[model samples]
Target: MKIGLIGSGDVGQALAHGFTSEGHDVKIGTRSPRENLVSYSDASSFGEIVVIATPWSGTKAAIDAAVAGNFKDKTVIDVTNPLVMRENGPPELALGHTDSGGEQVQRWLPGAHVIKAFNIVGNAFMYKPEFPHGPPTMFIAGNEGDAKVAVTRILTSFGWETIDIGGIEGARLLEPMCILWVLTGVRSGNWNQAFRMLRK
Candidate 1:
């Protein structure tokens, strides 16, 4: 499948390369295509699936740049964290409790199938994450069942086990795990670890 990535940052680039390595056609969208990325509008229309990997703060702008109607019924992946900078420290979720970035994306692209994933781990561990412990779990959610299934297959191809925690609102639960991930990194100076769920 052709995958269009809406952000050219670390997360976007990492996943683009990962998918390309797996023989999927990938295009990255950014302000600078001279830097080997495509313009946002092109990307939104370029792929079978589009991934929103822009930083939380830049999400709206990225979405606007992506040609509003181009996303209709397309599979849109949300890999962004709503991390708002806090004074004297790291960031916290800007939209949560009652709403989340994922929900906002759904609102922004009302016709798109917005599935959230890959927001819980560092980009370094996103693709083919192999730790001594075991395969990590990727939690995903979306209103579109077929879309989530496709994303689950993508996650598995990227070397992750997955848990579909239900509809888009499930992001309320999944996004917080990102906070814990960042806190663990800051506190331990280790950003290499990924989350895993064990069941007997």
Candidate 2:
């Protein structure tokens, strides 16, 4: 599988490395047209799976610049969160409590199948996560059932147990999981911790 990543930040880099290590062709997209864009555009033209890893603020522009129409009929993994922090304070979600970044991305790219995954967990534990017990659970949601299944397979390949939390509307719950994750990191200085869904 050829994967096109729209951001080169930590989350994007981690996922790109993970997929590349799993024998997928990976292209990291940037704002500047450079060494990778030619091949990246070719992959996009050929209908490769694209992952949007840009910051919440830049998500729309990134999708717009990447040509969302090119991603039509393609599965897009949305891993962005809309949290803006004040100086030395806790982060505030830019989108209202009812809305989420994933839904916004979905709205922007109306034709693309947008699945919300990897937003719930910290990037440190995103690829090849190792826990004291078994694989950590990852929560995913999207309107397209098939796309969610594909994303679940990818999550399993990356060493996570995936839990499908229903449609894109579930993103309202999943996106803020990042806030809990970051708060834990700040309070305890543990960046590697991940949430696991437990059942009796």
Candidate 3:
């Protein structure tokens, strides 16, 4: 599958590598292609699916520039969190409680089937994560069942234990998982930790 990664940042590049390593073609959509990226429109046209990896602050503009209509009926994986860094201390969520970045992305691109995933974990564990216990669990939510299924297939390929927690509104819960993930690293200075679910 041709994958459109709609950001040139770390998340986008990491996912690009993961997708390519798995035999899928990837094109990164960014403001400048000269910096090893593709224009949003070109990347959208080149892919069968798209990934939204822009920082929460630039998400709206990035989607707008990517031509929202072009994503109609396409599966879009939203890998964003609404945290903005403060001038003083730790970053804070820009939107939450009542709304979330994933839901907002769905609103911006109404025609696209948006699924929220990869926002709950550090990028280091995103592709082929190895743990002493088992694969880390990934939680995803989306309105379209088929879209969630598509993301599940991709996640399974990349090595994750997927747990579908329901519709897009579930992002309200999933996004916070990122805060917990980051706080561990911030408080302990260890980025090697990951969360795994236990079930009998």
Top-scoring candidate (TM-score): 1
Reference-based TM-score of each model: 0.97, 0.93, 0.96
> Model 2, residue 185: what's the lDDT?
86
lDDT, candidate 3, 27-117, per-residue tens: 8998877766889988877778899999888888898889998899999999999998888766788888999988999999999999999
Give lDDT: candidate 2, residue 139: 89
Candidate 1 ranges with C-alpha deviation above 4 Å: none
- What is the per-residue lDDT of model 1 for residues 40-64, given as tens digits with 9 covering 90 to 100? 9999999899999998888999999
Candidate ranking (TM-score, best to worst): 1, 3, 2
lDDT over C-alpha atoms for residue 137 of model 3:
90
The true-versus-predicted C-alpha distance at residue 142 of model 2, in Å, is: 0.4
Scored against the true structure, residue 106 in model 3 reaches a CA lDDT of 92
User: Model 3 — TM-score against the truth?
Assistant: 0.96
lDDT of each: 0.92, 0.83, 0.89
- Across 121-163, the per-residue lDDT of candidate 2 in tens digits comes to 8787899999998999988888998888889989999999999
Error of 1 at 62 (Å): 0.7
